[model samples]
Target: MRRVIGLVLLLLSVSLSAQALSWAYAFVVLDGRVYEVMDVAVLDDDLGEVVGEVKTMADDMDGSYYGDASNMYPIGTTYRKVNGEAIEDVLAVEDESGWKRAEYRHDAPFSMRDHLDKVAYGFVGLGLVVFVMYRFRRTR
Candidate 1:
């Protein structure tokens, strides 16, 4: 029974440590100001064929979650349209330049931050109590 309890606690600690990396829309800061990522047009490169129509209209993007144009993807410094506000797949764009592919990672919703905060703090408090109990019991 003691071994089983220890295993469970170890597993829980490992799971918390290995939590998945959440996505966030990180803006590439330049020139001391946040410049909008303009359309990453595809040249005659093979990357162009991979990115579809999304690259052509990046300039017209209203925001990360809106507009007919595509949002900037972190996967590649290019434009990719996610159906609805949720990012889905990558797309290509075309213009006088050529073609290029794009993918975007947007900031995670606020709920994720709250949930992570709770989990992290909870674990810390639990660990502190467990350590104190173990030390006291050992001395006794």
Candidate 2:
């Protein structure tokens, strides 16, 4: 019973840790408000290393709408982390160099980051399987 409880706790801790590391954040000024982006990336040279982000917008008077940026933002624009507010509520965007600020906006989600994480997990899982199998065969 004790061993089982300990194992469960260990697994829970690992899952929580993995969840914490899985998401990445960036900030941009879209329109006028500041927004914390769930995912962002530097565009390739072919795209000019500049990205035009399309974000969702809403106001009290106007209904929710989607807005696309007219200007392109550099991929590596620098941003500083902000504190005081809850992590989820705080948007990390640079006012000057990191990123150009516009109104608060929610950009289209980036999937490449998610794909990369899955790929990394795949390689790690493969490596562990090979190592375990080798050890088992050696013992036999």
Candidate 3:
């Protein structure tokens, strides 16, 4: 019984930790301003030239949950991207340099951030199943 409880607690702790990490927002400093990349997407093909690199990183884990983008876009790394056209609070940009009428499609690859909630729920569910199985076995 005690072992089962301990196992459940451990699983719960791990789930909570994953939840915390899921809430972390990746931020990037561009043009002297800090902008949180709402959706970190990877370009399918190399299109643009190296415009800028991540100069600094600040991870504020206090409560706001803002973190650095070193994991996805590491510091000193450069990628190809066309000029950015700000759309409200989001920066919509193309990945290659081409004529305005050129056809282009930017499809983002699979990202774990998109399914973090499901993963967290899976952890909790596994913990619950373990606890229930332990109780069932003791009763039997």
Candidate 4:
């Protein structure tokens, strides 16, 4: 029974630790620029060609809390993108002619900066409600 308990604890700890180290974001490089992307899909249609290869893989430590380019394409691996759409927000690449090589949905990472105003307003509203309740109780 003691051995079983120890095994359970060990497994629990391992699982907890693994959950803490999750990949938060992924990125790709094309034409000397880096793009934050999500929902990457590689289709089986031949409509794209090789554009560039991944020259470097971002390190996990490079970005805080998995925000870095760590979860990136493997180094030295070639990638393809749809022509005339490279500069746009979304990027789609192709490996050859029959299938879509890769498609990257670009979007900014979730940051407190983007929603600071909303958060501040929420806090202010909560405080106002609390203040009104306090005033009502005091009057009573």
Residue-level lDDT of model 1, residues 12-84, one tens digit each, is 9988775433323323221111223336653443342222222112222223221223234332344333233
* Number of the top-ranking candidate, with TM-score as the measure: 4
Model 4 earns a TM-score of 0.38
What's model 3's lDDT at 80? Answer: 34
lDDT of 2: 0.42
Q: Which residue pairs collide in model 3, if any?
A: 48-80
Over 4 Å off, model 1: 1-110
User: Could you give candidate 4's per-residue lDDT for residues 1-140 as a string of tens digits?
Assistant: 99999999999998776433344555665543455554545453522566565554554643431121224555655555555555444444322333232334444345453366578889999999999999999999
Candidates 2 and 3 compared by TM-score, better number: 2
lDDT score at residue 72, model 1, on the 0-100 scale: 42
- Tell me model 3's lDDT, rounded to 2 decimals: 0.44
**Predicted candidate 3, C-alpha RMSD:** 19.4
Query: What overall lDDT goes with each candidate model?
Result: 0.41, 0.42, 0.44, 0.52
Q: Cα-based RMSD of the predictions, in order? A: 19.5, 18.8, 19.4, 13.9
Candidate 3 regions with alpha-carbon error over 4 angstroms = 1-24, 38-42, 61-73, 83-140
Residue-wise C-alpha lDDT for candidate 3, range 14-46, written one tens digit per residue = 888743233344444444334444434444453
**Candidate 4: which stretches are off by over 4 Å?**
1-23, 40-42, 64-70, 93-140
Question: Least lDDT summed over 10 consecutive residues: which range in candidate 2?
Answer: 42-51
